[model samples]
Target: MATDELPDRIAEIFNGSTIFITGASGFVGKALIEKLLRLTNLRKIYLLLREKKGKAPVDRMQDIFNNVLYDKIKSLKPHALSKCTAIQGDVSQINLGISQEDREKLKNEVDFIFHSAATTRFDDTLKYAVIMNTRGTMYMLRLAEECKKLKLFVHVSTAYAFPREKILYEKAYEPIADPQQVLSSLNWIKDEAMQEMQDKILGDIPNAYTFSKSLAEALVYEKAGKIPVIIGRPAVASFKLTSSEFINHELATEHVRPSPFAMMDCRLPVFVTFCLLRYPQLKCLSLCLRMHIEIY
Candidate 1:
């Protein structure tokens, strides 16, 4: 396919597909939704979001529609708003904390799932990380299996899942700790005990975020033969040429790591991996960039 025909070809697969996206309120998740809603006219996008502090998912999504980023969506297809639906759910909980009715609605109809909800905090305790990142993924996999019409389970993982080794490549890596052991122990470990074991548990791995993500990837890999799943290990995310928001340096700065030697003016690169047999059309990009940098 010609380079110009690539996007359209990639979009064809999702033209009528039903997509369930977790962590839709997150930075990457939001961008994924914007592209889907604007480009392909996806059949339905079930947004799995935790009811924030007090607001319901619908209210939160409405607020999203009002944001400047969605101005293009509004102008393009004002009536297409009905194609989107927000459901209250938590990634770390069984059935995503959705009611039986809502769970059925998704399991029976959704075709693809993008799992992105994660506790990205570096200092998160092993217990919380296991619950949210490791166990949470197990639950998502179970849910994906229930989707009779499901075609793909796209998991958003981190490149640092392997840590800053001398060299990193486009292949799967194993986790340091026993994921099953850590998951089983989560129920019994107190918050304070987990906190104490943080350094010891993660070991050579950088932090709880990376450790949990690594464990989660292991879980997804272990189930590979039985399911159609793809793990996307993304590095740091920043502005893309097609992104709606003007490269907002201030907003993007918080996500970048802070280092004394880091350059402030370099662009990041992303590498994305996919299962060609399953999702032949879509393009995946894995992003890697400095922690502290200004984007133009």
Candidate 2:
């Protein structure tokens, strides 16, 4: 749906809510933030971003808002732009590296959360992937647990996380391995040793990224406790070079569907299509999930 055309159900769910998000600089994260900022009346959105390369998280957030995705809101719903705040944090760290003040504020005020940060590189080592994807998720869930008003926690994974399955199902399935144990073992292992043992550890899995993501989802299911958790597994889609190229690419394939909030609780999957490149002010879709989601 376009920003001006969000459904009542979605609007109602989001109205006046404070949302905390991880991986706001990534493809799906940008899309999700843009959609929420423009499509609804929200209280606030706190995006967790680590200070890196000498750029502060707030500076990086300004660059994100300068995107085409926020163009319409900048001109029309200008106040919406002000609702986005950047918090300095790293998911790979304990407590996500959030300051004590910020952490306490989020615990008391956040109404929703989205965890999208993960190590998706095929060449990434198991040790690194576990830290970012598996332990990162565990950390986010812990934070979500503290939120006094949390309604939902959305965890983004990949469709190919379970590569060995002939049919991809949407329910909680047993993870390939226990996430807690794997995370604990990272203390003594080097990246090289993990890489050498990757095949033996992953077995039928294709890559460290997918394998870690599966374990992350398992952690969410097993540890979310009272918080409603939705696992989103989006189908694989390559980055398109241009709008016409993206359209042409889409025409070349038919399996992809636009789905937003498909896995909210146990609700049936729903497709919600929105374009990532149409915004003239934005230059990247690296944070976009692009709606091809299967929620568990």
Question: Which candidate number maximizes TM-score?
Answer: 1
* lDDT agreement of model 2 with the native: 0.72
Q: Candidate 1: TM-score? A: 0.81
lDDT by residue for model 2 (1-296), tens: 79767556655667899999888877677767877876678899999999989999999999887755566567778788789899999998987999999999999999878788877789888888888999999889988888999867777778777777777765676788988789888987777887789889988788889889888878887754566666667775333223453345445768864223211111111112111112323221112243432221
Q: Every model's Cα RMSD, please?
A: 6.1, 9.6
Q: TM-scores of all models?
A: 0.81, 0.79
Question: Which pairs of residues collide in candidate 1?
Answer: 256-291, 257-291, 270-286, 270-287, 271-286, 272-286
Identify the runs in model 1 with alpha carbons over 4 angstroms from their true place: 1-7, 240-296
lDDT scores in order: 0.71, 0.72
**Deviating ranges (above 4 Å) for candidate 2:** 1-7, 237-296
Worst 10 residues of 2 by lDDT: 264-273
